[model samples]
Every structure is written in structure tokens, then in C-alpha cells.
Target: MRPFKSVPKARRGDRVAVISPAFAAPAISPAIHEQALRRLSESTGLIPVEYPTTRQLGASAEARAADIEAAFADPGIRAVMATIGGDDQVTVIPHIDPSIIAANPKPFLGYSDNTNLHNLLWNLGVPSFYGGSTQIHLGAGPGVDDIHLRSLRAALLEGGSIELTQTSESEDFGIPWEDPRALTSFGNREATEAWEWAGPRKAVTARTWGGCIEVIDEIAMAGRMPPLADLEGVILLLESSEELPSALAVKRWLRSLGERGLLQAAAGVLVARPPVSELSAPVPSAGERAALRHEQRDAILGQMALYNPQAVVCVGVPFGHTRPQWIIPHGGSITLDGTSRTVIADYAG
Candidate 1:
């Protein structure tokens, strides 16, 4: 496994940067963004510092990268977080000065399109958390979910290992930000099923890599992916976005990874519970939703079987595009115990 560096934890009164490296979700919903800031400070006691382009929708890629660079270069800022994921972070990644982050390494919290940044940090040997979105997780819900808060604390203030538990219920998306209830109520939620496990019934613990598979595709096409050799014995984190791609689409993505020898290089794979319904699309029936998840799971397992049958695989752990998400480590350690049917994350301080 590559030696990724763990950044120092932030003190209660420290400052953390909140920037929009992708879509400026905060620009569209300032109320939610303000609420998220309040909750973040109240929960962790760390003040959030926003950059100039944080709320500037359609800010140029260079402008976004400038905020990121300034945040990392600032000694007072102990961590950097994204407001929400968007479609075009691939463009922003190139403008970032790698040396700024390399010199002043700090914890970064985000997922989805932020995967591009995570992969950059991983290559720079800096570790990051994979599931905190200030707008989606902290700002829009009734309150920050307990599981999310625990992992958030682990990644930022506190540092330790915590079991990744399944929440009794999960929601694919929250209510529209324009609705008043979006602040006080959760979107439609349903009972969750146990995570499905496959491959050998054994334990494999290693540092993690991989994120929103859609972003991974873009990174690969841009030639930003790490060498396949670096992934040897690492746990692969794979999750879909709110785009709700079909099962065949997911299969093709995974197949591409496998063909590039990524799947075979990993000791284990961890898949997130995907979102099946888009806010704009008609809601799916419960059975339809279940079938969609099952098809995705089967597609993932088939690819894993073909590439590395001995690798431990677990599907449907809530981490991406799901409410009550766990802000797990990106380049830090995670243990996949197929024998015990458990997942534990290491939040190194």
C-alpha cells in the first residue's frame, strides 16, 4: 500500500475553509448554506471560512482553483470542504497548484465530483474524507444525521476507528431546496436492507481509494488515475451519483476499471448504496427501487468475479448519494472483514 499522510486534527476554535470547487449549490440556496455553516460550527466548534468563489455560480475553473489554492496555502485553515458536488470539477482540477497542497496538507471533506480532488490528494500522499457535503448533508436536512456527525467528527476533530453501521432508514435525495420543508423535513425514506457480501469469507484491511465512479471515468479519460500497481492490496470505494445510470452503464464503468487491471489490483471492494430516483424524475415504486439496487449489485459482483474472485466485496453501505451518509476515509484505512460481515474506518489524527 502507498504511504498516505494523515493531517493534524483541528482544534475546536480553529478555522476551516468552505469552498465550492464544483457547482455553487450555495449560490442557489443561501438559506441552506447558512444553516449548514451554523450547524457545522455548532457541531464541531470550528469556524467555517468561505473563499471568494464559494457562492459564485459559473465561476471560471481558474477562479475555483484559486480558492482551493488559497485555502490550502493559508496556515490558519485546518481543513477544506466542498459545498456540494457538481458535473465539471474535472476542469477545476488542472488549475490547482499541486505544490500548495503538498506544502500545507490538510484534511479535505467531500465526495462525488470532489473525487477528482481526492485522487489528486491521494497521489500527493495526503489523506481525505469521502462523504461530507456542506449543502446536502449539513444544510438541507432536519439536522445532521447522527452517523454523519460521528464520522465527520472522526475525520475533523476526533480521531479513531468507528464501525460503519447501517442506518435503519435511508433516503436517496432530500426535498427540493426551494421547499420550506427542505429545511425541517427529510425526503421520502424507506427501510434499508442489509449489505450484501461476496467473495472469500476472510478479512482484508488496507488504505482506501476510488470514489464516485462517474468522476473516476472522467479522471481516467484525462489520464489522472494512479497507476494500477499503486492500488495493490487497497480497498476500492465505488459509488454512483444522482444521475441514476442504468445497470448496463455501471457494468461498463466497472468493466473498464477491471480491464485496466484496477479490480484485480485491489484486495477488497466497497460499494455504496446508490440513488435510484432523481428529483426531476418520477419516483420509483418500492419494488422498482429494490430491483434497481439489486441489478447494480449483481453487475458489480459479476465484474469482480471475472477480475479477482478472491477479493472481498461488500455492496450497499450508505456513503454516496444517500442520506445518513458516512464520511469515510479516502486515502486512509478501512477494514473489510468479510468473515465478520463488518466494515470499520480509521480516522487518523
Candidate 2:
């Protein structure tokens, strides 16, 4: 596999493309989407540029891919961001030309189903961010989470290393976008527990890979996954989405990756705090939610123990499908120190 390279950061006042490669979330709630755009511009100083398919609901895969191509092809567009993640982005991957992104490499920020695009960029030897959804993080919330904004700046405007920290509070799902209070209020938040660490008490530093495990499954089935040899010595970032897969499901997914030698190839693994509830479903009780997280953590640890007990592992650092997210790198550097249990991410790539 080709080594990934860092993309140039955008300066204040530079233009950034806000494309909807997965779902046209903006079309569902234009009010929140517009507010997110304003907040993005205000918080980062980069102009938000939108493409035709950015807000077009039910856009064709080819059209979405073209918007992505145009965003990268334009030298003026310093970064590309997704509005929000949705199902079926896997179908859009075939339409994107890897060369276009490789030729004009730049920061691409997103998570969840956007993992498909991240994997595409990973294979093309380009680094991208693994979190940040304009509709989810910027628009629906009362304000941007502090850690999120800091990491966003690091990924786009500032080139620096930051030690990941807990926000003490987290939310599985926020209010519905249609609710007027969604813009001015936060969701039902609760205190969080400390991250759980396992494996050898050693530090592992390498360029990061992996994303939503569900998406990784799709990429693997599509035969788009990089060789296990390429993943050697890398820190794997694994997390689940709002679908709230059961612990058994997560175990099956990780076991599949392990069977494929992905687990054994990694130097370390960092699993995000998985979401336990969703807006469409009744909120689980506090104990039930904690139990869910624990079950998933144990499942991951069990699989890792069977596959690569030597690799350092940490679970429950908020990054994917959760609030107060830290937009860590996709194909960039991350240091997992098991002895000290610290996760320091280098946004400089």
C-alpha cells in the first residue's frame, strides 16, 4: 500500500466545499442546515461552498461523486465536508476517481457512512478526518462542542498535536432537527466513564486507519479494503453507528476482521464510545446504556485477546456517533500509550 500524505490546511477566508455525498440531510431540515453553514463560517473563518447535489434529495450516485470530484478538482476549495452521514454511501464509492483526489489532496471531514470515502482516500494515500457532520454537530446542537471545534481547527487551519480528553458528559442522540429547541438546546446528556485500556502496557504510535465497523464490513465485502500487510503497525479506529448494533453483532464484525488478519496486523486499537440509543427509539435506562457500552467493550477486548493480545487497546474515547466528538485523523498519526493510557492525535499528518 502507498503511504498516505498530508493535505494542505485551509487558511482563514479560504473556501471549503460542503458536499452531501451520502444523504441530503440539508433537504430534510434546511433551517438547521443553513444555521450549520453560518456556524461553520463563523467558527472557522473558511467560506462554505455548496454544490448542486449537496442539498438534492435522492441524488444519483454519479451526481454525488461528481460533486466530490469537482470539490477536489477545484484548487480554490481547500477542504471538503459532508453534511451528515447516511446509509448507502457505499454505492457512491465506485463513481469517484481516486486519481482526482490523489492529484489534489485536501482535508475531507466526515464519519459514519462517510467511512467509505475515508477508505477510498486511505487507499489513494491521502489523509482525512474521521468526524464532523454539519447537520449533526454544527446545526442541531445549541453550540459546537469545545473539543470538536478545537479538533476541527487542528484538522483544517492549525497543524498541531492534541491529547484526546474526555468531556465528562456525552449524549447518544440529540433532539430531532425539526424541533425548534434542537438549535438552542443540547440533548439529554449524562456523565461518562473513563476509557478502558487493555493489552500490553506499551505505547504504539502510527498512522491511524479504520472507522465505523459497519461501514468497514461493507468495504471489505466490496473488496476495497487495503491489504493486511498495509495495516501492519497502524492504530485501528473502530466504532459503531446509531443503528446501535448489539454486542453480539459487534463481536461478529470484529471477529470477521480478526479472521482476515486485520486485528493481528495492527499495533494498537482505539474504539470510540458506541451510542446506546437513538432518536427514533425509546431511551434506554441509564444502567442499560452503561451495560450496553460494557458489553461492546468486552466483546472488542475478547476478540482482540484472541487475535492480537500484544496490541495495545483502549475503548470509549468519544469520536464516532456521539456528542462532544473529537475529529481525529483517518490516515494520520495517533499515539496510543497503554502505560499512561493517553491518546494523542497529530493533525499535521
Candidate 3:
């Protein structure tokens, strides 16, 4: 693999491509995507450029791959953003020409199913951000979450230490995106707990890896990852999407990580604030839903104990499937301080 190199940051006047490499939710939610584009300009001072298939519904995998190539090949586009996430992105990865991507390294940002793209960049030894889907974060109508904006600037503009802080409040459920009002608000906000850190009391900094745990399962199952030794010293960043997989499912996936030697290979682990609810999926009873997050946290700890007891682990960082998310660098440096239970991300380097 080529050595890891930082993709140039998007400057104020620079143009950024908005591509739907995964699902074409943009076509379904054009109003919301418009708001996303508006916010991209107002919040970042960068222009949002669109590709032919960015808003096309059921675009062929080849078309999506072409948009990706164009985004990177064009020097005018300093960054690429996904409109939203979908489930079938795994199919699109095969169509991507990594050589084209490696030659034109630029910051690419998304989460959820977009993990496919993030992984592609990581394997190519290019640094890309792990969060900041335009629809989810930029189109945040109440305005972007300050925590997310702060991290976005650090990664794409300012480039410095963006400390990870528990979002004081968060919402995992939202009104349907079809309604224009969904573009106006994230529905409701509720208080959240501070991060829960377990494992040894020590600090370690390494390039971060992993995203959207469920998608990672796909990556692992597809054998898309490099050798276990290549992952040594990486800090694993895991999160669940709006699908809200059960604790059993999460444990099952973690069990695979252990089997594949990922559990012990990483220097440390950071889990995002679990999305306790998934709007598009079946809703559990109120009592059951409330307990899901606790189960997920314990499941991870239990798996770690059985697999990699020494792995420093922290849960509840706001990076995925949650409003006010941090745009984490996919292969960038982050410090996990066990004593403080704080994560300081170094995006500049």
C-alpha cells in the first residue's frame, strides 16, 4: 500500500463535489439535498458542486464510480461529500478504480453505508474523514451541530486538535425526510450520558480505522481489509447506523473482529454514541428501546474481555448516526487518553 498521506483541506473558495456513491436519497429528498447544499456554502464558505449521477435514482454502480473518479480527478474539487447513505454501496466498490483515486487523493466524507468509500480510501493510503454526510449534518436545519462544525473545520480547514466531547443532547429518531419540515429540524433532543471508558488507564495515539460497525461486517466478510498486521496500532472507531442492530448482532460482529484478529490488532477502540432508534425500521417497545444502548455497550466490553482485554475502549463519542457528529479523519491521528476519558484528534498532521 502507498504510505498514508493527508488529503489537502478544502479552502473557503474551493469547490467540493457532492456525490451519492451509495444510495441516491438525494433524488428522493431533493428539498433536503438543496438545504444541504445551501448549508455547505453558508457554513464552510466552500462551493458545492454536483455530478451527473449525484441526484440520479438507481444510478448504476459504474455511474457512481465515475462520479467518484471525477470528484478526485478534478483538481478544482478539493473535497467530496455524500448526500446520504444507502445499503448497496458494497456493489459500487468493485467498480471504483483505486489507481485513479490514489493518484488524485482528496478528502472524502460520509458514514453509514458510505463506509465502503472510506475503506477504499484508507486501503489506498489516503486520509479521508469518517463523518459529515451532507444531508445528515449539513442539512441539519436547526443549523449544524457545533461539535460537528468544530471537527469539520479542524479536518477540512483549520487542522488542529479537535477534542471529542459527549454531546450534551442527542436524537436518534427523526421525522420522515420526505416532509420538507424534516429538513427544518431533527425532531427532538434528549440528554445523553458522558463517555464510558473501560480498560487500562493509559494513553495511545494512532491512525484511526473502522466506521459504521455494521458496514465493517460487510467489509470483513468480503475480505476487503488488509492483513491483520497492517492494522496494528490503529484505533478502531465503531458505530451503528440508523438500523439500530441488536446487542446480539453487535456482539456477533465483534466476535468476528476477534476471530479475524482485529480486536487485538488495534491499539485502542472508540465507539460512537449508539443510535438507540431507527426511524425506517421497526420500533421496539419503549422499555426495550431504552435498554438497547446499555446492552450494546456491555456487549462490546464483554467481547473485548473475551478477545482483547488490554484494548483501551471508550463508548459514547459523537461520531455517527447521531446529530452533532464529529468529522473524524479516517486514517488520521487521534489520542485516546484513558485517564481523562477524552479523545483529542490531531487533524493537522
lDDT of 3 by residue, 280-326 (tens): 66766667655888899999989998988788899888888888788
Clashes of 3: 0
User: Model 1, range 1-349, lDDT digits (tens) per residue?
Assistant: 6677659999999999999999999999999999999999999999999999999999999999999999999999999999999999999999999999999999999999999999999999999999999999999978999999999999998999999999899999999999888999899999999999999999999989999999999999999999777888899999999999899999999999999999999999999999998899899999999999999999999999999999999999999889999999988999999999999999995
Candidate 1 deviant stretches above 4 angstroms = none
Worst lDDT run of 10 residues, candidate 3, spans 1-10
RMSD of each: 0.7, 0.8, 1.6
Better of 2 and 3 by lDDT: 2
Candidate 2: clashing pairs of residues: none
Q: Model 1 — which ten-residue stretch has the worst lDDT?
A: 1-10
Task: Score candidate 3 by lDDT.
Answer: 0.84
Q: Runs in model 3 with CA error above 4 Å?
A: 280-287
Q: List the residue pairs that clash in candidate 1.
A: none
| Total clashing pairs for each candidate | 0, 0, 0
Instruction: Quote the RMSD, in angstroms, for model 2.
Output: 0.8
